[model samples]
Target: MFKLFKHLAFCAAFLVAVSASAHSFKIGELEVIHPHARPTTPGIQNGVAWFGVKNAGASDDRVIGVESPIADHAEIHDMTMDNDVMRMFKVDGVPVPAGETVTLGQGNKLHVMLMGLKQPLKEGDAFDMTVHFEKAGSVPVQVWVEQPSAASGAMQHQEDQHDHSAH
Candidate 1:
């Protein structure tokens, strides 16, 4: 009775929240899904954003650039460990093969560096970013600020496991 009604209400609210947080944008044959970044401290000047690009077409594409108003500049970067120290370097692009999905986060080793952030990225906040593709052109997306999920615990360590084209 009352308990059942309360449970149903909770479920409804949960569904709404999930749908609101799940975002995607499409440009040509590429679909940019759930672009997100971890919340950062007030004094942190740099942050990273991650997303997956799904290429449904019969050709390959590369993410050549990124632009965000919240940062002075953004570039594709790769994070890896060299010896016992971590190293990050700028990359020319991240390739998205034909009929494949390329993820830039969740331990896949590539992320976009939002350099010189204008403000701290707080949880539950979102900002606009444009992803430039060599073939598909630029697609505008909203990057959500959120905490890392338990499944993405590897992100907390800053360790990554993929290789990319270095510039």
Candidate 2:
């Protein structure tokens, strides 16, 4: 009886953890998954947010805008290497192809620039933001502040150790 109870407890805890990390928001035919950002240090006025947009509809959509209470303003920006120099520029919108997923985050060259941050973003903290889609309308998302490697599972084996030391 004690072993059964222990097993059930473990399963319950596992389910909760999985559900908490699998958060996503849907608007129209678009699904926004796991909006997240990295922790910002003090005196930093700028930060970036990243997420993946999956379009399930037949037509393509575009991410036009982003609004967050944690920042003075936000804009969609893309990075490119030009003449051996890295350049970041503001874009009107990011195209999300039909039946495809576009990821905006580290190494993806696209991200949401949160300008004039109201406060420093700390690990384990969460903030609310609205992602505007051209065809899907606006979708509200909760962005989690986590380490890049941990959130993307680039260091999955060290995730537990990282979380323990980070938090």
Each prediction's RMSD over C-alphas, in Å, is: 5.0, 7.4
In the range 138-167, model 1's lDDT, one tens digit per residue, is 999999999886666677556333322232
- Among residues 3 or more apart in sequence or in different chains, the pairs in candidate 1 whose N, CA or C atoms overlap within 3 Å are none
lDDT of 1: 0.85
**Model 2 Cα RMSD, 1 decimal:** 7.4
Task: List model 2 lDDT by residue over 23-102, tens digit each.
Answer: 78999889998898878899977777788899999999999999999999998876655565555678999889999998
141: Cα error in model 1, Å? 0.4
Query: What lDDT does candidate 1 reach at residue 47?
Result: 79
